[model samples]
Target: MNYKTTKILWKTFVWIVLIIGTIITLVPLFWMLSTALKSNAEVMQFDMVWWPEDPKWSNFVEAFTTLPFGEWTMNTIFITVFTIIGTLLSCTVVAYGFARFNVRGNKTLFIILLSTMMLPSTVTMIPQFVIFRELDWINTFYPLIVPSFFGNATFIFLLRQFFMTIPTELEDAAKMDGLGTMGILGRIILPMTLPALTTVAIFQFNGAWNDFMGPLIYLSDPDDFTLALGINFFKGENNQVQWNYLMSASVISMLPSLLIFFFGQKYFIQGINLSSGIKG
Candidate 1:
């Protein structure tokens, strides 16, 4: 019960907790991969099959071929690309304005905008559906892609905070060099904001890629379905759930998100830190 012994015991406890948490978090992912490699018989076994005896590597190939995974992936990519573009274009400008401009009612307007976030989407989902229905946007990408062109509250807030961290002296110097707002944004702000922009792009990409609700609501054509909806479709297409194929499809679907995060992790962490007011 000396100080050194107590500190060592505390560190041991913390490490044990962290190890347990890590295992808990990774178990589902491990299960999914294991199931993907299993046969239907192996998957349906009474005892838990942690790993398959005969790993069917062909499940990945069959997952794509059995379903229109390629086409669904293309549809998803198309939606995700446009969603990222729209979110970046709209959120950057709005955030920049909120961070830089001293227009009248600016604070009030921003507060109102932020307030919208507190209003659950379920409250407005019916109204939005009605409007989209009137516009004949059902079964089209418009309902899914076009909304991002406006702005996202959470992304706007993140970008706005990051933008505020930038020195106004830069803008002043740009103005002295005859750079107007757009010129300064393009020449000065953009290069410096790459981390934050990448963060936003990654967020939007993951969201649009995994979006099931939007595509389910707006899309009717099986061919136009996003990967998320396609996965659901694959689940329901068979009377008995083919857990192997479903798990294989899910594993394939998650690769892009995992890859993006793996590559962009440094920028993502930096952006989050900067936006949260931690300088450097």
Candidate 2:
């Protein structure tokens, strides 16, 4: 084939692949929405209706009303917000220290931090649970949010990688202007690393929002349950499940993450850039 024709054919092939991938990804979501909107009888029908035959939009409302969904959502939101804030603050400060400072044994300490990442949480879960119980933090939101303030090794490394790309000249200039380290970090580094920060926040938000095991293991009070736990409440004795309500709840649970990714996509792209470039 001629060069122009070959290129045209390749582009067409790429578009076809993308179109098929999009349909594959969206089909399940479409089915979930259709099932959520269908009446109980329609949902059980042997004949599939890709679109609901008799839409029962009230299922969304019923999903909320049939359980403590409102309370669970509020609890989840509260935990997610606090966890994101804590992770960002702690991760950024630690990353800044690692990227900018030359403290004694800093490398060794950082290696140790990285090592902790390799240690499976399951190995430490019992110990962690015992410690939290001793502190009376179990069954409280403290177990979920407070530890994030200490720092996460992976996020710290990500931010530090990004931070290392920043030009030292900017900081040197800031110092010449009589700005302290804190001032330079606060004004220059923090502002410039907004993309990495946003990325970290998004990750932390998703982690905190979808956490099921942590909440299940730590919290005993139904009042403190999160959406993930609340969804489990829909299951009953004899292995019976409310598939429709569960699917509806699942869709609702995913909305916040979807909304966040949609709005914060620019920052997410920026983070990918930082990850590929020099730390600043």
Candidate 3:
């Protein structure tokens, strides 16, 4: 085959693979939406249906009525907000320090910090639980929110990487204008750091938003449950599950992350740009 024909064939194969992958990813989401709108009888039908004959918008309403979904929603929003705020405040400062204000042992300390990421959380879960128990904070939102205020390794690394891309001339310029570290960060650097900050906020928010294991471990009361655990309340005795309401709750759970990514697409793309460049 000629060179042009080979190129066309390769492009056709790539397009076909991408189309298949899209269909595979979309099928589950499509089925979930269909199931959320399905009546009990329709869901139990032997053959799968792509869409429901009767779309039950009221499944969402039924989900709310059956569970403390409203309460869970409020609780989740509260936790997610705090988680985002704490992560942004702590990570931004720590990252700025690492990137712009290096000190003695700073390099070693950062290496140790990055090394922590290689260890699985399961290794420390029990010890962490014990420490929290000693502090009398085991069954509270403290377990979820407090550690976040100290900054996450991944967020700090990501922010630091982005911060390094900024020109030091701006820092010197700001200093000449009599602005200190905080002044420069607040007035000049922080504004440009929006994309990185947004990326961190999105990750932390999504992590806290979808948190199930932590809440299950630390929350004793049903009232204190995050939405992930709260939604699981739909399961009852004999291991019977409420299909429609469960699917409805799952669908609802996806909205915040969806809305965030939708509106923040521009900033999200910007965040990726720093690391996305490839050198020849």
TM-scores of the models, in the order given: 0.96, 0.94, 0.95
Backbone collisions counted per model: 0, 9, 0
Candidate with the larger TM-score of 1 and 2: 1
Residue pairs in collision within model 3: none
What C-alpha root-mean-square deviation, in Å, does candidate 1 show against the real structure?
A: 1.3
Candidate 1 residue pairs that clash: none
Which of the predicted structures, 1 or 3, would earn the higher lDDT when compared with the native?
A: 1
Off by over 4 Å in 1: 1-4, 236-239
lDDT for each residue of candidate 2 in 97-132, tens digit (9 for 90 to 100) = 999999899999999989999999899899999999
Question: For every candidate structure, what is the RMSD over all alpha carbons to the true structure, in angstroms?
Answer: 1.3, 2.0, 1.7
TM-score of 1: 0.96
Candidate 2, residue 168: CA error in Å?
A: 0.7
lDDT agreement with native, every candidate: 0.94, 0.90, 0.89
**Candidates by lDDT, descending order:** 1, 2, 3
* Candidate number achieving the greatest TM-score relative to the actual structure: 1
Residue range 1-280, candidate 1, lDDT tens digits: 8999999999999999999999999999999999999998999999998999989999999989988989999999999999999999999999999999999999999999899999997898899999999998898999999999999999999999999999999999999999999999989998999999999999999999999889988899999998999987655544778889999999999999999999999999999999999866
List candidate 3 segments past 4 Å from native. 275-280
What is the Cα-based TM-score of model 2? Answer: 0.94
